[model samples]
Structure formats: C-alpha cells, structure tokens
Target: MSIKLDYKPVVVLTDYMYDSIQPFQDVYDRAGFEFRPYQCKTAEEIIQVAKDADAVQVHFAKITKEIIDALPKCRLIVRSAVGMDNIDVAAATAAGIPVANVPDYGIEDVSTHAILLMLAITKKFNILTRTVQEGMWDYAVTKPVHRIQNRVFGLMGCGAIARCAAKKAQAFGMRVIAYDPYLKQDQVNDLDIILKSAKEVAQESDVVSVHLPLTSETKEIIDREFFGWMKPGAFLINTARGGVIQERDLLQALQTGQIAGAGLDVLSQEYIEKDDPLLQMNNVIITPHAAWYSEEAEFTLLTSAAEEVVRGLNGEPLKHPFNKIPYAKQL
Candidate 1:
C-alpha cells in the first residue's frame, strides 16, 4: 500500500502558449507530474478540459466561477503574465485554489516599452513617419518638440517595472517623481525620485506614465478629475492595466487638448474596435498589450508558471502567489 501510494500530478494549460513544453516535460515527469496543453476559450470548454487537472497554467483564458466550481481536483492556477485580471481570482480563492503569476518575468521588457512609447509621443514618431511615407519630408512640421532633458517623468506605481522605468528616465536626463502609497519614504529615497501625491505628480509631470496593478481601488483611478490635474501639453503613457484610466475621460481630455498626446499599451478592451475614437486620433500610439513580450521573457514566463504548478502539487509555497488563503489541500 505504501509503495503504491504515489502522487501523479496533472498540470493542464488553460490555453496554448508560444513556448513549447517539450523541453520541460522530463522535469515534470521526474517530479511526478504530467503537462498537457489545451485551447479552451469558454468556461464549459475549460471545465471539460481541466476538470481532473491538479494544477493549471493560464495565459488569456477566463477562468470563471462555473469552471472553478467544476474543477474538483484543481489546486493551483498560475497565470503566465503579471496581471491576473482575466482570471476570476475571487472565485478561485473561494474554491481554495492559489493563484500565482510571473510578476518579474518581463520587468525589463515592459520598462523598455514604456520608454519607447514616451519617446514616440515626444518625437511625434508616427505622424512623422506617415508624413515621409506620403512623399513629404518637412522636418519643420515636427518642430516645437521640447527636449526630454530637464522634463519631469511622473509615475503612478513604483513596483519592479516602475523602478526600472525611473532609472531609465533619469538616464535620459528626465527628472523622476512617483506616487505610490505602498512604498515607504526610504524606498522612494533610495530610488532618488521625489515622492508625491497622485494629484501632484499629474500636475508636475511633462510625461506621465502609469505602472500600477488593476484592482477595484485602482480601476478608473485616472478619471476626469485626475486628468484635469495633469499639466497641459503633457503626454501620457499607460503600460499598466487599461482600466486604470477611464477611456471616456481620456477621450474627452484628448479632444480638449488637456494632454498633448497619449500612448497606450493596454485599453479597457484589449481589442480596439474599428470605430473607436482613439484610432482616429493621430496623437495616440496604441499597441496590442505586447509590453511584456520578448523571447527570453516568454520562455521565463512559461517555465516559471510550470514550476509553480510543480510546487503547488508537492505542497510547497508558490514563488509569486497573489492571493491569500488558508492552508489549501494539496494533490
């Protein structure tokens, strides 16, 4: 009986990832786990595909309450990205499954993306490119560009990515200031960035960048009032969650010229509709939420998520567990 009692974990991927799992298959097998990939897009599909899974890794699949309730054997959910907004975290918590994310996997990539957006907006990269393509090379048309040096680069949240962004901004000769209630004064001091309230940061910055997580309190934090405080002609960049800034307010602000331009990597909706107003605005630079991607980052993200599943199945602590729950039953 003792010899026969062995744990064989079933680690199911909620959706396909770019990184192949073949390389890590042997590692999982050695640890008494099996890795299986699925292309489940709906709740019912997820329930059918992962009902018997001991652990699951998610990329873009929405793990709803129905799927959570149906998975009787699932003990862990590891999101490939930092944001777990796509997954129903509350439902998973209630069901006693710990949710983990690869929070540090793409810090450099995301920070670089933030800087890229900032430079594009300041230099009018898109419109200038379009002008040249239209057989016009009027450099004066892109005149009136203010130097980034000596300009303020304001940040909303000072997490790992934000810290790197601050360092990069400073290297470009921009002054950095941040608004993050969670960080202590000493932490901000160590970064050599002035710590201020959100309103103050918005008012003083020449280029304001958002780098916060999406939570109930943070959703729509950058509404009309917050936008109203921003310095006129200042550009805005959001490498953070899209819901952090309200789209309606942002649209109004842009229409009124409250801000000079905007660069968004995420939107309230990931897929920008064909008729969206932002699409018509020549000042906005929008990317399809690809801030957290690089060959190395994707590999790290995929492997890290798989490792979390192994840890959860073996009753070990997860590296980047986001939620708090009492001792969960292990596989």
Candidate 2:
C-alpha cells in the first residue's frame, strides 16, 4: 500500500489519553493539517515522531529544547493539562513557537478536591477511618477538633480554580484569604476574599490551601520559613503542582509538630520513593496526583486540549495562551 505524503502540514499528538482524539480529525481536515496520533514519552521519542509536525499537542510527554529544535516545521505546542511545566517554554519561545494550555477544564474538580482535602485533614478523617477499620470504635482518637466555622482558609493563588474553591469554602462559613501578587487587591475583593501577604496568610489561617502555578518564582516557595509562619497545629493542603513545597522541610515541620497535618494530591516527586517519610505519617494524606479526575473531567480536559491545537493551527488566540506568541507561522 502506497501511503500518500503530500505537502499537507501535519498535526501530531504527542501521547494518547483514555478519551478519543477523533473529534480533532474534522478540525485537522479543515485546517489543512493531517491529524497524526503518535505515542511519545521522552524527548527523543517526540523528536522522532514530531519532526515534521506543524503543531504538537502534548499530553504527558516532555517537550525539551532538543525536541523543539529538531521540529523545524513546528509552530505551536499545547499542553493537555493546566500546567505547562512539562514543556520547556523558553526553548519553544526561542524556536518561535507559541505555548498554550487548558487552564479552566478541571477547575470544578480540582477545587472540590481541595475542599475535600481541607475537611479531611482538619477533621482527621483518615485517622478515624483507619482506627475504625482496626476495631477501635472510640471517637477519642480524633478529639480536640476545632469547628470549621470562622476558621481562615488561606489560598496561595486566586486564579480561576482558587476562586471556585473560595466560593465553596465560603459556603461552609469559612473566611477565605489569599496571596497572589499577580492580581490587584480589588480583583480578589470582587470574589469576597481578603488579599494578604504570603506570610500573613500562612500566619493567620487555620488551613492553607495552595492553588498556585509552578514557575521559577513559585518553586519551593513554601519552605521551612514559610512553615514556621504557619500557626501551630494548622493544616496544609496542596491541590496544585507539588514543586511549590519542599518535601524535606515539610517533613521536618510535621515531625516537630509545627504543622498538624497535610493533604497532598501531588508531591515533589510523583513517583514517591518507597521510604518517603510522608507515607508513614497518619496526619499526611497522599493521593497519586488524581485531584483533577472524574470520568467527565477527563473527557473535558482531552476535548478542550484538542480544540486548543486547532486554534493554534489557525493562528487564533487560544482559550488560555500561557505566553506571548513568539511567532505567527501558522498552518
């Protein structure tokens, strides 16, 4: 069988998701790019399969400069999820390629996950579950719990997802405070959330929920000193990327009882080592980075990502373009 390799530009999807990529076929056909699905993980794999691609839609694949530089025909890169940390944006910028992501797809799920974690940590839900399973029926194991009302719920970022979380937390009669220098105080005020300094939020809140993005500035932003500012026996929750917290520092604080507990949906390393200290602590609730999951949410995320690539290919502004488009070389 002779496969035709005409002058038509190609759109390569870096990896597959449980959801179908069939929706993209019509978009690709209309945009003059042939939709090609390829399974690529490492930098080398991406470079090999996407070398001639005009636009690349990356799922869980790493888009390194080596791969970016190798793709001479590539014009745009779209991340399947909210975070663009998986891709080397600087390298793509240097190569004159624009980077875009779907920032709003999982706002409902992730925010709800944050609220769930907050309540579980504060109420000692895991401890109670384990104790009951082990034949201990006494409620004394979870004694001295404070009421949720009037407690400060601190947010690290007041972005779309965090805003949704604020609304949910407020529904529980909790005061929502946030620290996000990117947004003006009035913007946070519009959401009925008090804008405070990072330290102030940490110092005052009974529970701190992180919803910040992972950037150079935000990486390891929550270190030992930040933990020191936390109220004694306060709870910490992270539904955002994990690089924002230093795990060793978090463990130390937990060990010293400076912080009461943590609810981590992500970790500094997603492939947590077998001997990870946090794994042994009952106060710590560790999930396999699945906060943004639901059968419905997964489909939305995949479908939205495919649509963003079509926009990129058409040289149209995306739903959430992370950076200023470095170039306009479109399909």
Candidate 3:
C-alpha cells in the first residue's frame, strides 16, 4: 500500500530560535522531503528564502499576509509553539492553507509552574528568602501570610492547562471557579469547578490565575477595570501570555493596594530594562517566560511540531489545526 510521489516536497523553517533542527531534519529526511531552514525575522526574508516551500515551520518569525501570498506552493504552516499569534491565520485561511500548532506539549509543565507561582507568592518566598540571605531573619518583614485552605482559586480560562490547574488547586483545599465562554457548567462539574462570569470570578477568588491565549480579544484584557473588580489584597498569577495583563495598570494596582501581589512568568515585554519598576517590587515574582520548559516538554514540543510537518506532507490528518481549510487544498 505504499504510494510514491515523482517529486520531493520542499519544507522550509522560516525561523527557529532553538539550538538544533535535528528533530525536524530527521522527520523531513525520513519523509523524503527537502528541508530548507532560514533564520528569518521579517516577512521579506521569509518570502525571499521560502517562496516555493510546500510546507512552512515557524518559530519566532512574523508570518504576514505578504509572505503568505508569495508562497504559491505552500499548503501548510506549522507553528513550533502553542501560540500562533505571529502567523496571519486569517490570510492563510483565505489562501486555503491549513495552519497548525503544538498546543498540548507543555500542559503539565506550564500548569505546574502556575501552581508554583501561586505557592511562592502566597508564602512570600521572594522577600523571605532575600531577607534571610541579607543577614535579616525577621518573619515580621513578610508577615500576615494567609493559609490557602478553603480559599477561592479562580481561572480566567478553562482549557486543558487550566483544567489541570483546577484539579491541582482543588487538591490544595482551594475551591476552584472558572470563566470560560466556550464551556458549559456541567462540563466542569466532574472537577468541582464552579462556572462563573469573569467579573464574578475576579471578585470571589483569593487568587486569580490567567490561562488564556493572547489574541485580539484577550490583549490587555486584565486592565484597570478588571483589577477594580478584584478583591483587594488578592494575588494575581499569569503563566500565560504577557499581553493579557496591562503592565501599567498592574503596577498601579500594586501601588494602590488593589491587589496584594503577582506571579508573572510572562510580561508585556519579554526583556525589560533594568530600570523597570516591576523588577524592584518585592511583592512581584517574574520568571523569564520559562514556564514551558523541561527536558521532556522540549522534546515533545520539537517532535510534535515535526510530526505535524510530516502529516502535512503525507496528506494525513493534522492533530492540532489552528485554521480551517478544505481537505483537498491541504493536500
């Protein structure tokens, strides 16, 4: 039942920031596809290098409409990460190109990281650790820490990662409430997560964790208005995209005591200047967008992305499609 094509398909990596493309190479080589990789940062570079690619793999490069229109032979686009914000999905849809992403690769790693942030902030680990190392062991510096038992844990989104977080939060004796427009109340009843409005979740929870993807609707969604709805002295955790929370408003919330503290794995900006005030705040914990890291997660992410490319070339079903395209065009 082996079918062979007369010509070898060309697969291009628009840009990959990782140290090695060995995973992609192995998949493409086994499939008898030509692998062309370029470290492109802009649409112009991608167009010049990969105009005739049959399938494209992207990492950090911005895939614009112009580049999509130029790729006359491209039928598939696979983002190497969970988020497809860099790719112009709408344009790809119009052109009948199927776009895909590796969404579930780091679910456990990211959800676990969110819970870690929650525990660290609740216990005031940052200030306590620093004070003791600075030759001061006064528990009074970070006093008033509250027990997490019986507290309300709210999730802004209830996707796979959020659902995982909900179970973990429940295990901590915290009541889990969530707001997800796409899910029904009964859908989450098995996990004991109460469905509520976003504003209700914000007001009721002692700790609000963000788990939504970054999109036009979600960009800067957690602004002053959302903060105003939150209970004073409540903690905020964002292991999702940085743009979901407005940085300036978050700073004001912290300054005015609207919220007690924040644990952010992602920021509005990836690399902040040393002078940025968020760095100086004792109540805030920031990680370098590394919530999706672990040896196992990295391997899954890389191999899953390559598997998608294989599916695209062999006309097999894509497991994680981001855009809808006719099956005929996908071939």
* Best lDDT among the predictions, by candidate number: 3
lDDT for model 3: 0.89
* lDDT of all predictions: 0.86, 0.86, 0.89
TM-score, candidate number 1: 0.93
Pairwise lDDT winner, candidates 1 and 3: 3
What's the distance in Å from true for residue 290, model 1?
1.6
- What range of 10 consecutive residues in model 1 has the weakest lDDT sum? 1-10
Q: Give TM-scores for every candidate, taking all chains together and pairing residue i with residue i.
A: 0.93, 0.93, 0.96
Q: In model 2, which residue pairs have backbone atoms overlapping below 3 Å?
A: none
Q: List the residue pairs that clash in candidate 3.
A: none
Candidate achieving higher TM-score, 2 or 3: 3
Model 3 misplacement above 4 A: 1-4, 326-331
Q: In model 1, state the lDDT of residue 278.
A: 94
In candidate 1, which residue pairs get closer than 3 Å at backbone N, Cα or C atoms, i.e. clash?
none
Question: How many clashes (backbone N, Cα, C below 3 Å) per candidate?
Answer: 0, 0, 0
